[model samples]
Target: MGAGQSKAESDEHFSEEVVNNLSDNLASPDTPPERQSSLDAHIRSRIQVELARLREEEEHVREEIERALEKENLDRERDMAGDETDSGVGQVKSTTALLGDVDELRKQVERFHSKKDDDDFVAARLKSEAVVQCYKNNPSTTLDCWKQVDEFKASVAHLEERYVESLR
Candidate 1:
């Protein structure tokens, strides 16, 4: 206890001396050249020492962070391993059921796709989008979209004919 207290007191005194030395150097610019050089060298050495201490502290902190990260990773791996043996079994069963549902959905989707005429549907959708965009761009001159509206109507009619034929 006594040694620690004395060390703290000495550190405080050392810092005070450094501060006083800096102030004295700044306050007395006309100080003797030799004294000024000595002060400069002292301040530089103190700065280098402080920098080295900071670097050592930084390395220690980096090591601690790496250790913590590794611990967390190990914990995560353990949890993942535990999960695979427990809830994961139930999940696998549910996933298998879901896969069967997906296969049924795929068959239905294929049947629906067979009824669709892609070319006619794409033409109709494109024409519809063009008409809507024309109306949006020319809000005040809605008549300017007449050509687009006609094209959209024609494409939709063609698409409808294809759909009815597919139904037959």
Candidate 2:
């Protein structure tokens, strides 16, 4: 194996030396016709081979860069997704708290309406009872019953004002 390696090394050196000599000769002003075409073909083939190799190297480098960029983009997306998930959890908590507050407010409103209805019923019943009592006490004149009716109206107005003030 060692002998073969040495032979290969010597062959490479010899080929390099031959190519250098040919290049130097061809570059001179006194170019020979017999060797001109052969040397020109050889030089053209060498340049084409080098250009192809360089192109392959460029493609390989481009592929490596693309892979690296793709991985970086994926990592960035994952980080953004994680942040969104964290914010989303916070939003859900806040929404839940708001909903609880709304429910409590709805219950309070329902209770207030219930109380208002009860007050109305009581006031109406009292007015009716007062009217009947006034009629029984003053059966002689309908004019005397105006006082009780006016008093009942004033009481109902006062109750309405109180209810409005309590809401405020």
Candidate 3:
């Protein structure tokens, strides 16, 4: 047989020997009835104590496991929220850049129209009107971008506050 199998067999034999010894001691006819009852009660009390200790240990382990799971869940949620905030900031940056480009384009178009003859006046006016309409449609877009950046900053501040509170 393998070494592992031999070791297992030995362990089983040891356990059986221990059980036999315990049974023989408990069943000895030389033991007085009152003494035997007292011994039994003492054994019962010891078993109850051991059981209570084991139950307490089990409860402690369960509480630790639950705390770890809750911490992991909170960390996952925090990471997801951070990713969403980053995506929002990226979008806001892109929109801000596009607005800047549009403003530059409008300026260039105006310069070109100013240098042109009266014949181009109608086309230049139409282009300028279109630009004006675009600005009018979303007058608060730039303001909104600024607000988003501010809000992002505020969120960081709030997180710091919460972290400090937790430490306390």
Each model's TM-score, in the order given? 0.39, 0.36, 0.36
lDDT of 1 by residue, 1-168 (tens): 999999999999999999999999789769889987999999999999999999999999999999999999778766766787686563332445669999989997897786454777778888999999999999999999999999999988887787688669
- Top TM-score hit: 1
Lowest-lDDT window of 10 residues in candidate 2? 89-98
Q: Give one digit per residue, the lDDT tens place, for model 2 in 80-157.
A: 667777878532223456699999999999988787678665786688689889999988986789977987888778
- The lDDT of model 2 is 0.83
lDDT of each: 0.85, 0.83, 0.71
Q: For residue 121, give model 1's deviation from the true position in Å.
A: 11
Clashes of 1: 0
Regions of model 2 farther than 4 Å from truth: 1-28, 89-168
Q: Please identify model 3 stretches exceeding 4 Å from their true place.
A: 1-28, 88-168
Candidate 2, clashing residue pairs?
A: none
> Positional deviation of 97 in candidate 3, in angstroms?
31
TM-score for predicted model 3 compared with the true structure: 0.36
Best by lDDT: 1
Model 2 scores a TM of 0.36
